[model samples]
Target: MSEVLLLLLLLLALGPGASALPKPSGQRQTGPQRNKLLLVSFDGFRWDYDQDVETPELDMISVRGVKAKYITPPMLTMTSPSHFTTITGRWVEDHEVVHNMMFDQKTNLKVPHKETLRRTEWWDTGATPLWITAQNQGLKVGSFHFPGGGAHYSGQPIQRHVFETPGFPDDNETEWRENLDTVLDWFSVEDFDLVTLYFGEPDNVGHQRGPDTPERKDIVRQIDRALGHLRRGIDARNLTHNLNVIVTSDHGMTTVKKRPLVDEIILNKYLPLLKLASFEILDYGGFGILTPRPGREAEVLESLAKVPNITAYSKSQMPYSFHLGRSQRLPPVVIQADLGFNLNSRLIVYVNKGDHGYHSGEMDMKTIFRAFGPDFRQNVVSQPFDSVHIYPLMCRLLQLQPAPHNGSEEVTRALLVQETDGASRLVSSLLLLVSFLFFFV
Candidate 1:
């Protein structure tokens, strides 16, 4: 009788029907089951933009989940490269998306962001994106206007994606709502595990008027209201408990006060030296790449180094911290403009009042990152982390095995609740069943 009583007590302690047992010291407890994840990106949303704008929806999310003070984007903080890095968890060098407009010397191909949708070679190289990884693991994935959404990877595109229309302005409010509604519709579909939504707002307006201008603030408020609508829709459908939502930006914007023509400095001033170069690609305002003539590499580097407000580096001498020199698409000589300066051609007449693609170390180039859902701790504020860390967090929330990538678990693990072991739970269930049989017999 004593043995039977002991068995009953043990079953009560270990049974699956019992509440979760206390975890051993130093063992982290896992979060609740989070089967759905939604990632949203606001283009060029600066880290501090929220402070000046009234973002009730974002505030609610931060109060409910976790918000990073700031997130440092990868070097060459351009839209396409930063977005790809955020999804792939690798630096631009490793991912091979060196810039927004990439020129490949071997194929003599110039692939721009819009054209990249159909060009597999541009995005399919290096690490696979989160969407592809999730889809391969049997989770249905969908994207609405997210970068890298249209690429056909592993012989398949995202299950449902809205491709950007060529030359169509993406800053319209109506278009933004339509895209958000489409993503919400996707969530209602059967077994949709992951969905990505993008909005090109404040960035478009920021560029036209300047990051600190009143016009930019108004646009930010407009975007905030739109997000509120999205939140209400999710709540209406009772998905707030099941979906993990993350809101971030590709990069942040900085004011561009001067536009320096690259030709005046590189071509005209150093014409004799530049003529020796085989190709010169000065696509973005912040960075320039020069593919020198076979033997004139030293000459090109020397001449460009003399240009003011521009720092030039030979491929081998590029900073290790930037992690930019490894890709074949990189030129022999790379040039970066100092903060607040735009490097352009003499033929170009107009420049946006605001721009990005500056060095990542600039605070103005930092962006926002906030997440709210069952998988995250409520009311938590974390220190600034690199945007690359987000990839691992996404994998964890979706309960998928992360592919081998540059992201570190140590960087993002603290933000997540340690999960309990399923095996332990199974053993508890078996013990309870045996105890029940003995008692009944």
Candidate 2:
């Protein structure tokens, strides 16, 4: 019994080591084995955009790799919150990036686009992003214009990164090609293990001219060409087999006319009924948050309930699917406009032609997700999933332990191949043997 107890202790000590190395799912190698990853985000790329537009590069990736018909972004599908959620695998509520422009009443601080990238507290908030996690594990990570990629978390930034400054020129074809070239250079020269690339496209054009318009389709074509450049560079470097590539988007966009949902409802009918502390019109006109003064919360909710083309929810009454309302950053009362409608604000006169922050359940809010690489299964089509699950998949590909996050491997398990090496199998068997002996000896 004493000998058996000692053996059990030894097995327990080896448990962590056994799980440390991931086993290759198979011996299939299309090219040189390079364990690298690239995550690309095409801002505002809708799930169904490909139906109308021709995206040869994206289509090729889908043909050669796994394609998810759609990826449902977390609720309040704004750019900053959605992108942060993609990297952290945490809900916006948990990550604390509740909105693109975060307003903290305690400090009277408003984080605009210019300041959003610089504010560490608004981004770090204890949750570790995938880049940081990889870096912590001694993997070199790089980023080009990815949100939260420029900022330092736990006193460390990605080894290589470039941030777009406020008021930078819109990315034309030349700039897009340059961006891809830079990424390829980093991969070849710097030998980064994980890299992220962001493109603000169809989102910008989609906002100026509605997503359904030919103008947005033109931009999509341009982005598709840029993707071709990236693929060509990868093939040139012979990294196609070794490097995994995932292309996705933060949120989808929808056309919004000047319906003035807020004016006809909140301003005309509800404003007089309550004492308001502050009201924020967020994400073009699709979302709003209302903070009632002390003792006026009930009145605010009661009055806004009658608004047309809008849905209102008290913080506590928010839907479980949203996964919001748990943070202090969220306002007491939340409001969202119905599809094709937008909230009107007295401060802003120019309304965006396209908008997104509506409920994620809407099909218009869905985004595209495609991946190709050694770790991923090829020639597959998957059902829709939340973008938050992306972080876990990235961690799995890079062989890094993920930080605490809302995503689960079960959500992305089907996209991956179950490759185990002989060593991994041996360790797994030993673990099973130890467990069996401990239980039945």
Candidate 3:
């Protein structure tokens, strides 16, 4: 009877079954940690998206979970790099996923944004993402339509990954449900410990219809509906108790002024028009990377300095505050247009009504962050923070040893419940003492 009782106490101390068992002292797990985690990102969800829409689901979670006023993404706030930064806990410079597209300086060749995601050379440069890290530390993780989800890091595959279509699409409500179901199945049936799910939304609509337009509002409603379904799905699958959920975004959207309405930063308009043969221009909405041909650095700088409403810099000279200049993949010259403007090669027709890729300090570039579940505190709303801090938060959640990252575990400590092991450990120790007495004394 004493032995059976001691076994019961041991099981209780270790958590439901043995999945939450702590590793060695170096990788000591903390808190009454949850059994699993699910990270969801709705592309281009601005910090204030909940204000205008009836986001009952998001609002509900804020009260039941933890909410951040906002979180700043890294510089050149686009999709892939920012998402990678969230997972790796590194700034754009450290992770080296500087932009959406991949480019080779030697050949001046470019890969489309979608193709760039699948290319291993760009993603596996150095940092190991959460999927790789968690799996390396003995956890099963899945990625569903997330940026860098499909690529192999150092030739190692994600335990599970899904990205059926290219280009973040919108008219796929049914598919969204199917994907959520699949993830829930992974957690319940396949015993996955962590999964990252992504949805391309308001970001796509915002680009075509502008951030403040009615079409954008409709997309926001769609996002709320999706959130509602996820909430219900969690409860239905009995995962609300053990599954921690964090919903966030890559970056926010801002309106872009077209040529007729406002002056576009046309590179040719600047004096000493950068010769086509002497440079490689990668212009994406408000951000542009200019790779000057050898010996043409002086000419490129002079021409870019002449352009009004544009902040231009060489890779070595990029503003230190932005934390964006360290990547070897970055080009010779970089330019950022002032808000409400875009960098265009030529004053052409058809501009995206909305765009990101702005400097990190732009309020419009900030993103959303929401988290909840067993391990998180209730009804705590936090001040704005950088997204890089999220990776450390996740590492603590899983009790896994995090790879070298720039974020602080303390910065996100406020969001979690205080660790409570004193009573449990004491009772467990007493039980062991009694068992020893019964066995030998």
Candidate 4:
């Protein structure tokens, strides 16, 4: 009987059904940890939600879950790599997506592909996305308009959709509306173990008009309505008991106060003009950090730094405390703008309404994350966290092992079961006991 009791105790302690069993150390799982996850990312959300425009729908979701005021992004605040980091749990440099545009080192050419629809080498991602991982574990997965996830999961038993429009920034609203319709249709058809919805309008509008602008607010409202539809879908299917909804953005967008230094004419004249080795955006400016190819650093900086409205930085002189990567592909100098400055390329020179290829420090690069589901706690988390942590949090929700991510487990505290054993160390640097002591004491 004692042996049987010991076996039962082990089952209760480690098994998913062990909630009611007391730990030998006299503890229990924390509040509620999610079981299934639905992550929604709204591009170009500011980190400072308090200072940004009002978002009633977002606030409601936050009140029902945790809301982080700051979610630091990877080195390059571009959309493609940032989203890649979010799902793969790695930095952009580690994932091999240094920027929005992927260039071939040998040919010295750009590989062009549409945002979500492109499946070329330029768009190839290194980390396994949550959809693929979930499906591997027999969970049903679905995503609407999340970049990097484009149709990769399509025809694989998981329902994945993509929307791509040529020269889209000019007609973002129309495309977003059409994508919303598609998402609504998917929600209407079948029950999903997981679902993701992404909206690029806010990011697109914010890039052109700034995050707090009137147009940005309008975009937020439209996304809010779409989320409302999602909530109603939850009710229609009575999924509140099992479904977990997570909302977040890749990175925040900011407004450039100053003008661009490398205008179209200058860029066109200099691109093929310079018999240079390589060029890269180190941080957030033309001059802030520029790494020229080997012997070309001095000449490249001398030429590009001379431009007004640009700041240059040596590879060793970056401002913020971020460990980008240690690789041969890393540039020797990074360039950024002074406050309110942006870089102009051939794409932006002629357009009246323009938004492309910006890595500005002032571009309100903050993103948002809020979650509500069976596995979430009813509390507001206003601390700073990174979006890369979401990948592991989703894995925990589905009760599966996740690929390693760079973020600390403290970022995922809100996603844990109340009074549980502890967060897996691989997921966080925090000592669970220390966190508990700090919170309680």
Q: Worst ten-residue run, lDDT, model 3?
A: 17-26
lDDT for model 2 = 0.79
Identify the runs in model 4 with alpha carbons over 4 angstroms from their true place: 1-34, 49-54, 112-117, 151-159, 165-191, 258-294, 302-321, 327-333, 345-363, 415-441
Tens-place lDDT digits, model 2, residues 171-224: 578988888888887878877888999988878888889998989888888888
Positional deviation of residue 10's Cα in model 3 after best superposition, in angstroms: 22
The Cα local distance difference test for each model comes to 0.76, 0.79, 0.82, 0.57
What lDDT does candidate 1 reach at residue 99? 71
- How many clashes show up in model 3? 0
Residue pairs in candidate 3 whose N, alpha carbon or C atoms collide under 3 angstroms: none
TM-score of each: 0.84, 0.85, 0.87, 0.73
Candidate 4 per-residue lDDT over residues 1-441, each given as its tens digit: 445544554454455642422222212223334344567777766666434556676777777766666676766666777877887777665665665655555455554435424654444444566677666766566777676666353334235555555565633555655565555455446545567777675666766666556777777777776677677766765667766777777766555443444332233334332365354332222222233466776776667656665555665655544445443444565555544454543334332233323443334555667788756766667576666777766666666556556755556855544424333331232343345446766
The TM-score between candidate 3 and the true structure equals 0.87
Give the range where candidate 1 is weakest over 10 consecutive residues by summed lDDT. 20-29
- Per-residue lDDT of 1-441 in model 3, one digit per residue for the tens? 567766766666655533342432234343555368999999999888779878788889999999999999988699999999999999888999988888877776788887887888889878989899988878889999899988898889998898658543554888888888889899888879999998888798878889998888887887888888888888898888889999999999999877583566667666443453244553588888877767888777877787888888888987887788787878778888888788777555446899998887888888999999887878989999999999988988887788899998878876876443434464666777687777875
Q: Is candidate 2 or candidate 3 better by TM-score?
A: 3
Point out the higher-scoring one by lDDT: 1 or 3: 3
Model 3 stretches with alpha carbons more than 4 Å out: 1-34, 259-261, 271-277, 347-350, 419-441
Best candidate, TM-score-wise?
Answer: 3
